[model samples]
Every structure is written in structure tokens, then in C-alpha cells.
Target chain A: METEGIYDVQAIRAQFPILSRKVKGKDLVYLDNAATAQKPLSVIDALVHYYSHYNANIHRGLHTLADEATAAYEASRVAVKEFVGASSPDEIIFTKGTTDSINLVAYSWGKSFLQEGDEIIISSLEHHANIVPWQMIAAEKKAILRVIPISDDGILDMEAFKSMLGPKTKFVSVVHVSNALGIINPVEEIIRLAHQHNAVVLIDGAQSSVHLDIDVQTLGCDFYAFSGHKIYGPTGVGVLYGRRDLLESMPPYQGGGEMIKEVRFEYTTYNELPFKFEAGTPNIADVIALKAGIDFIKSIGKHAIRKHEEQLLEYATAKLKDIAGLRIIGDVKNKVSVISFVIDGVHPQDLAILLDNQGIAVRTGHHCTQPLMHRLGIVGTTRASFAAYNTLDEVELLIQALNKSLKMLL
Target chain B: MNNHRTIKNIEQELIDDFSLFETWEEKYEYLIDLGKKLAPLDPAFKTEEYKIKGCQSSVWIHSFAKDGFVYFEGDSDAIIVRGLVGLMITVMNGQPAKEIVEAPLEFINTIGLSSHLAQTRSNGLRAMIKQMKMDAGAWQVNAENKTVE
Candidate 1:
């Protein structure tokens, strides 16, 4: 796999066909990594391999095809467990995506532990996926939901967060990395603080899971949820890693065939551990493909990738900050590869349109974190997020495009 | 223009209004002016209750049924959003449920709003129009039921 320049940035670009296609008759500069990372050939090939060769439902059959599929599926789970440094594969349950995984915890955990006046703590930097489900659950259970405020730098205001934690705080679900601001909260500290109050913690790892190495045991988070798509894996597959005891204590999310051990009209028994939560047929191809994504990440090595990304962020920030009327939002020092900014004169939408005309793809909006958007006192911002595949040349092109777009708009 | 006065000639009038411009520039100019003619949104109407969810801009949409037609008043904190609402109301307002429901959305293409809008905003418009159409359909059904009674 480490053939001379085989994984070289330019060589890697050749594998993804989407990158080759011209947008507005110019080379595509996909700067929307926080939204979804572009899939590599290995991940794409894994999906094709699964569908083309071993396309069968797992766990229920003893036939050769079923056996092959089941092995592949379980292998992926083991990979995920290793990838996230979870203790057991039994702790990993697959779902639709990060939103679904968070919903699972909100409904199941909230139902089991929460009651009238019980408090759940979240941060100001949470995505709507992390925010709304908790809100719904809190509404249903008559629980008080508290928000931990953020500093102007976009990192979690740790002092405020510490103050917010108390005995009534049943659980704290917070974003490990904010999708909008790209700020990585100190989750280990958050989990520790929450635990001091006897509160369980769930980390919405949608953004961080891709960029950072995670160890649930070390972090001591009760549950962790992230989507595969954000990690260059296929969409429609996500993983929720809950401590075995907590997972066992909670009720199943959805009722379906695979989740049940035995089902009669009068009574039904859920299967043990992971399958009990993974209702219905899972996204088999995507789940299998996720292993390839994990492998790809491992092959590149997290340290090298993180170092590369930090350089990109530094370069992009310096260049963008230099541009007149460009105010970079969420200028926290501890951000991942995302940069959210608002131009003084041009609307983010208008800037985005002009950028699109130049074949530069960047996210412009509240980024599904409307409450956070409100807190920031802006309707939206233009976000340019980076990934390992993105090169310095692309960054130069982006700045050039911004210059041209500014000339056109301002 | 005289025939445009009658209810039977409404479609013809709309077509004629649409045909007034051979070029897109003239059509956009007409649409923008139409927006200008819209009575300014009451400042009080910008309350949180009137705000549409899932939009990047702060948009307030207020609708009421009058003379069996749904009339909408909208404003937004963002200029482009107001411009979008102006375009929406121009195509949609005054037309009864059946005609409005069946109106070709192709005018969005003609005005180039679809091409110009961000993907999320474009989807947001679809969601808003869907909600409006569904409400209108339900209203028409209720009216028909009342007539039968």
C-alpha cells in the first residue's frame, strides 16, 4: 500500500472520479469536508465488491453466501471497535447515520433515566441533530435541558460547563467537535465533570471521529455516535458505541426482525447487546465499505493526516484573514479542518454563488446548527472545510477564486 | 387588456403578463417591480411565530384566506430572501387553489432563481411551496365539503 507516491496527494485524486469532473468548466475544489468527506477509491471499491460478490443478509443463515456476508459484516464491526478503541464489538451498533445514532440515545437513554425536572446538559456549539432530539426527549420527559455556553473563540466555555453540571444533571450529550465552527471540545474533561455529578455523557463525534483518534474508555463517555460518510465511508451507515451495561439497560430503538430474539403476538424478547439496537436490515454494503474507510485512515496514519490538515487550516486562515472585509467566525485555536467566515460586504449566499461559478464548493448557511447560528448573531456563514485529499494548490485556487468572486460581487 | 378584466380571462392575463418581456432582463425587471408594489410587511409581523424554519435568512410568512384565494405576506432579514419571496408571491398569489397548485414551476427557471439559489435555499423554497400547496389543497377540500353540506 506504501508504494512510492501511491498515496501521494495527486495519485490519490485519480482514484475519485468525482474530483476529475469539471464544475463550471473548471477543476472542482471540494471544500465541504465538514459536510461530508469525499470517498476514496478503496471505500467505493469495497461497496462495489460487497454488492457484486457477497450480496446476502448476515447472521440468520447457515448457507455459504450468508456465512460470507456475516463474516464481512462482523469483520466491519470489529474494525469499528478497533478504530474507535472500544472494548468490544458488542458495544458497536450500526444505524442510519449520526442523526439516527443521537436520536437512539436521546429516546432510549432519555426514556430510561430521565424524569420530571431531571437535567440534560449540552453545549452551545451543538448541531441541530445533537440539539433537537434532546429537546424532543426533554419535552416528552418533562426534563430540564441546560446548555453550556461557548467562548467567542468557539471552544466550550469550560468554567460555564463546570458550573452547569450538578446532581440533577442525568446525562450530558455534547459535540466532540462542532460541525459549524470546527472547534474540538475537551471531551475527556467534559466526561469527567459530568461523571462527578453522576451524569452519563454522550459525545456527538460526528466531526471529531473522522479527524481524531478516539478511545471511549479513556474519555469515559457513556455513548459515542458518528457517521461513516464524514470519514470517507459510504452514507446510510453510522455507529453508536455505548457501554455494554448502558446499552443493555436501555430499550430498543425500533422494532424489527433482526432486533428480536423471539417474537410472538403476546411477548417479544430482544437479542443481546448490539443487534438488539440495530433494528431491521442494516446498510450492509455501506457497513462493509466502512472498513475500507477505516483501513484507508489507518494506512495514512492519523498523526500525518492531522499534521497535514493543521497546515491547510493555518494557510487557509491566514490567507482568508488577509482578505478585506472577511471576518473568520469561530477562530478557536483548537479547531479541526473547518473555517466559517462572513464577508463584510457580500452575503455568504452571494459569495457562495460566485464561488460556485469558479468551481469551488463551500457550505454557506447556518450549517444545521440554527441555535448556534442565533447565538453567534448571524443568520449564516460561508464555511470552507478541509480534508487530507485537498492540496495547497487547491487552497491557492480557492483564494484566487475568492479574489475573483469578490471583484464580481463587491 | 380589456379581456383581462374577467375571471375566465385570468390565465390569459397571466400569460400576457409573462409574455410582456421577450428577454429575461425585462422579465426580472417586471418581477422586481412587482415586489416593490407589494405592501410592506408590518413590522409587528416579524415575530418568531411568523418565521419559517429551515431557512438561512430570517423569513416571516403570513398567509390568510380571502375570497377563496390564499394571500401571502412575506418579508426576510436578508435581501435575497425578500427577493425570493417577491418572486414566489408574484407567481403564486391571487391564483385560486387549483390554478396555483397546477401552475408550472418552470417560471423559477425563467427567472433563473433556481439556477442562482444555493442548494439548501432552493430546497427550502420547495419545502415552503409544498407546505403552501398542501394547505391550499386542504382548504379547497374543506370548502367543497361545506358546499356539499
Candidate 2:
């Protein structure tokens, strides 16, 4: 349990094979961790192990391979459950990703529970995945979608959020961390305030799950959803943790094989807890491999990982700030390892292309937060996000690349 | 000599210019330079209606038929994409409508620019090319209709 060498980023970097690869004849400097973290060797090996050994349909198979597959899949659920500090594995439903999880709640729960003129609250910092689902549900149900605004520094306006919540506020969904700005919202406070109004709160933890230690129990959020890929797991799999009673109350998200308790000509009874939301055969290998991703995080303690990332963030921020006419989008105190900035004369896409040509990977766009970009009064920003494996050296490379590219551009 | 400059000549010139750079970085710098030197489109023509679809960045390309040749005014929010627009314009602008429609534009591939550019940028470039061709095709049809009239 001793995380002695967890902060050794060089050791961590070796675990990701892609880190050694060359892009455009130079060393690959990946800074797009907020989009998707590169999988460690353990996670990759876990995937190959599952597919090579026990590739079979999970749950209801009496055969040995099926049993193995089912065990591994369910074990991943337990790993996710423990990772997020959820009370039980049954509370965790395997989802496609954060988008699928949000859509599941929006359609199944929102359609059943939301009434006309009811209010659903979301923050301006939310990714489109978090925003569009509520918007669709609101339009369909004739409910109102209220947005909590953010300040110039990208922190959510808590006072505005509190004023928005009332007797009519039926649901409140917010992002735990802003993917675009990297600002960590005050979700615990938001959850507490929403619960006071008897509103169900769903936290979009897509960007936070990798960087921060999460405890659904402590946070007291009704629903917490995040993507596996963002946390160094495979692409198709994700987790949606909901309160047991709340999950039981909502109807089945999809009615198919695994989600059914009994199928009758008249009506079919739904399965219990998590299975009620999961339909048909899931991403068996990916789900099984997700446990390895979680284990990878635990092996190198979250605290240690956070420390390393904070160092990288600080180093990168200072280096980037030193460059004249380079304006960072969000300068919030509580933020993850994401830095979004706009140069005075260079377009984000151009910067991205130039950096990419130098074997440096960075995301340049609205980061799927177009409304947030509009609010910030910019078309897009060039974002460099770090993972636990990222190092101070890579940060230096990014700064060097940016400086070189900007000089050529300006 | 300038009056006889064809779309093919311009594409060949671009290819020659690009071939001068040994490294991708140098080529990119040259591209940015090209983008910087591009004549700015009139603000009035940079409207959404004139915007080219399929581009990640906002690219406006306004085409008009003048003296039997198609003239294109182009701009983009992204400098690299604007440079790409400038490249496209350099090849197609002031070319006869028939020649514009018929031009192979193999120079993009010949210069290895197609392979060098990102998929989205290539797609956007193709979209711009398609739009220009469509504009030329329309003008060609209009000319034929006038002759019939």
C-alpha cells in the first residue's frame, strides 16, 4: 500500500508505449489528456488477456468461458464502484460513456418524472454531452432548463445557482470539472443546495474521475457518470452510479435481454438495480479491462498522481504565462491539469497544426463547450491537459513548441 | 506572360514553392507566410451564407464570374486554413469557368500537401474545391443559357 515511487513520472511514462513513439520524426508529447488519456501497459494487457482468454457473452451463460467473462465484467463493476466510493456495485450501471449515461437518465428518468413548467438546472461550464440531453428533455417535457453562469475566471456563480433552485427545480446536473477550462466546480455545495430543494443532482465526472478522488457517498449526488476512456480505460465502456432507491424508482433505460426479469406477452418485468439499465451484451473485453485501469490508478495512489499533475499544471502555466500576448482562458484556483489559452495573432487551429507537426498533440477548439466559448468571447482555445504520466519535461517541450510555432505564426 | 497564367501554372508554382522547404516545420512556416500575405476579403463577403461547409474553422469563399473567368474571394478564422484557402484561390481564381471546372488540381496530391494536411483540413479543402467547381459549373450553365436565349 506504500506509494513510494508513484511520483516518478519517468517510470510512469515508460508504462505507456505510445509515449515513446515518434510523431513527425520527433518525440510524441501528448497533452490532450482531457480528451482521452493513453492507456497504461497494464490496462492494455488486461484487454488482450480478456479477449484471448474469456471472450464470451456475459451473464446468463452456463458455459465456463461465459462464467469467466461474467465474473470479469462484474468484477470491473466492483472496481468502478470502489474507485468512486459508491456504497454497492449494484448501484453502478455500465454505460457506453458519459453521453450515454446522461441520455439514459434524461430519457428514462426525465420522461417519467419531469412535469411541464418544471426547472432543470445545468452550469454554463458543462460539456455539450451534459447540456444537450437536458435541453432535449426540457423541450420534450415542456420543462425549463436554467443555466448557472460562470465568472471571468471560469468559476460557477454559486449565488446564481442557489437563486435558480427552488420548489420548481426538479433536477440539477453539473460538470464536476470543466473539460475546456479545467475548473473544478463546487459540486459538493451544489449537491447540498439541490438536495435541500428535494431535487435530484447528477454530476458529470468525465473530466474529474482521473484527476480527483471521488466519493459518491460523501458528495451525496444522486447520480455520478464518467467515461472509461478519459480515465485510461477502453473507449466504449463507462460507469453510471445512482442511489439504489432512485435507480429502482426509475424505469428501465433499454428493454432487452439482460434488462428483463421476465418477458410476457402482456408485459415484461424489468431486472433489478444496474441490470435494469444495461441492455443486451455489453462491451465485454472493455468492461473487464476497465478494472485494470482503475487498478492502475490505485497502484499509483490518487494523491501522488494529483501532486505530480499539480506540479505539471503549475510549471506549464508559468511557462505559458511568460509568453507575451498568450492569454489563458481560465485562471481559477481550483482546477485540474488543463490549460486553455489564446494567442493574440495565432488561431487555435493553426497552433494545433503547427504543434502537431512538431510531434506535440494538443486540442484546439471549443472543447465541445461552444456556448462556454461564446460566453468567453472567443471562437476556440488551444488546450493542453496533463495526465499522471505527463512530466515536467513534456511541459517544457510544449512550451518550446508553442514558442517556436507562435514565432513562425506572428 | 501574367495574362497567360493558367490554373495549372499556379498549381505547379505552388508545388515548386512547397518543394523548396526541406522540413515540415519550414513548409508550415511558408504556409503561414502565404496566409499572412493573402489579400483580406471584404468584411461584407465574410457572412455565414458565403461560408464553406465541412470546415472545422469558419471559412468564407465568395465566387463571382467576371470577364468569363471565375474570381474567388476567400478568408478563414484559422491562419493555416486561410493559407489553404489562399492556395485554392491561387489555383482557381481568374481562370476561365470551363477551365476551372476541368482543372484536375492534382498539384495538391503531387506536392504531397494532401498527405501532409490533417484529415479534417483535407476534407475542408475538398469542400472548398467542390464549392468552387460548383460555382464555375453554375456560371458555365448560365453562359450556355444566355447563348441559347
Each candidate structure's TM-score, on Cα atoms with residue i matched to residue i, is 0.83, 0.97
Interface RMSD computed for candidate 1 is what? 4.2
* lDDT for each residue of candidate 2 in A1-410, tens digit (9 for 90 to 100): 64566367888889999899998789999999999999999999998998888889988889999999999999999999999999999999999999999999999899899999999999899899999999999999999999999888888999989899899999999999999999999999999999999999999999999999899999999999999999989899988999999999998888788999899999999888889999998888888889988988888888888888999999999999999998999987899999999989778878887888888999988888989999999888999999988888899999998889888888
DockQ of each: 0.19, 0.70
Model 1 chain A — which ten-residue stretch has the worst lDDT? Answer: A1-10
Question: Model 2 in CAPRI terms: which quality?
Answer: medium
Query: lDDT per residue, candidate 1, A1-410, as tens digits?
Result: 32233337776677677898898678999999999988889998998888888899989988888899999999999999998889999999999899999999999888988999999999898899998999999999999989998767676789988888787999899999989989888999989888989999899999999898898888899999999999989999999999999999999989998999999999999999899998888888999999999888887877667877898999999999999988989887888999999888566765676677678999998898888988888878999999878999999999998997776544
Error of 1 at B11 (Å): 14
Q: Identify the candidate with maximal lDDT.
A: 2
True contacts kept of 2: 0.71
Residues B1-149, model 1: lDDT tens digits = 33323323443555566766675435444544554455679988878777766455566777666667776788754444555677676656765766666665655544344665634553356655665676567667766787899
Query: Each candidate: what lDDT?
Result: 0.82, 0.89
Off by over 4 Å in 1: A1-7, A264-266, B1-54, B58-76, B79-107, B111-113, B116-149
